[model samples]
Target: MQAYKLAEQALVGKRNADTVALAMYFVPQPVSRKDGFRRTVNIKANPMGFATGSNLNFDLGLPKLMAKAKPVFCEAFRLEGHYESKSGYPTTVSVQSDSDGDFKVVSMQRLFPNVSQDSLQQLHGELAQQYASAIKAGIAKLEMKTPRVELRFMHPIMIQGAGAGSDEASKLFQAHWQQGWMEFKGKNIGLLGAMKTVADHNKNSVPACKPQVLTLN
Candidate 1:
């Protein structure tokens, strides 16, 4: 209850703050069923920004209400800041891995096809590296104890503002936990828990048997 109040207070008057926006994601977990088979659940968390005109807004009060009602969600969501600009580079990429330790980029697409190959590759590498780092960190933090993981980018990640270029942006995103730079209104949640919160926020319904990603508006 108190956490939601603080978060709301922090978000006050920040609706139109467009230069940078705070974003959060819920961590995913694996569940075992009665059939002796294991599978990941609720991986379709929506990616949203708190800035005005985005999927969420402070006036809706859902974000705050969610923060208060879902302690597990609060404990599991990962928070980060998006420094966006008109010059930002946007792209989408998907990653997959198996129990045999086989990992690779499944597919990638540049939002602007006219962009140079060098620019595209640079953006691709940065996106790939960021996702890989996040996945590995989530696995370690949550102690999921699984050697296999999968990630699919449902939305384009914007790279802009300071050090928006490939090399600099990579460094900035890789070291995303510098407390003094990012804002935290409530309790600090682990990567796994954050992912779960996002899933619930997006209302992802887990299937009876396998893991799947669903796109929600």
Candidate 2:
């Protein structure tokens, strides 16, 4: 399956999660021409999408991956809630937020036209209602529990092909320790545990997974 499809599936059932990644970039808009006609003017948009940020760099492929997945995820969320694309291209969706600035539902729209607008809009309304109902249930769950901090390991490394005569064994060992320090500095919970879980999920085959610590403050 395509990476975008995989991301969409992963995001389908998420609730109260900030699924949208925000970045900064410029957008071109039509302005008055010098001869009293019209011209295109470039203006900076606030909290630009990942694609725009990546566009500024020639060597980076991050934006390309993000661009591909943006629409798939947008449609998936639209099936659950409201999304308003402020700028037509590099679509940016404004999600409704509660008075406390918490999102009631995930908000985003596709930048490309690969999906039908009507289908996406209809899905958005349906998803929004479902999200609202889920929020109520979530509130009840939270009220029943004492708030506490919990951590889980997200990524771990494994030693492979380590031997006395291996050409790069010592270098690999050094790199592992260096990475371990970086992961430890982030105060990640179950860093090792998460790695083990993922390793087992991948059938003990080593896959490179970048660990990021998500802190709820």
lDDT winner among the candidates? 1
lDDT of model 1, residue 80: 19
Q: lDDT by residue for model 2 over 1-217, one digit each (tens)?
A: 2433334333443322223221211122223322221222233342232122111111123245345433122211111111223643232222221222122222222322215556545544554454442222221011111121111111112222222233343333334333332333223333344334433443323122223469998
lDDT accuracy of residue 155 in candidate 1: 14
**Model 2, residue 214: C-alpha shift (Å):** 30
Off by over 4 Å in 2: 12-59, 63-175, 180-196, 199-217
Q: Per-residue alpha-carbon lDDT of model 1 for 1-217, expressed as tens digits?
A: 3433333333432332221222222222323232222222222343331122211111123334434332222221222112212654233333222111122232332232223556555555565566554333331111111221222321111122222336544454445433221222123443233345444543333222123468795
Alpha carbon deviation, residue 105, candidate 1 (Å) = 27
TM-score against native, each model: 0.19, 0.18
lDDT of 1: 0.30
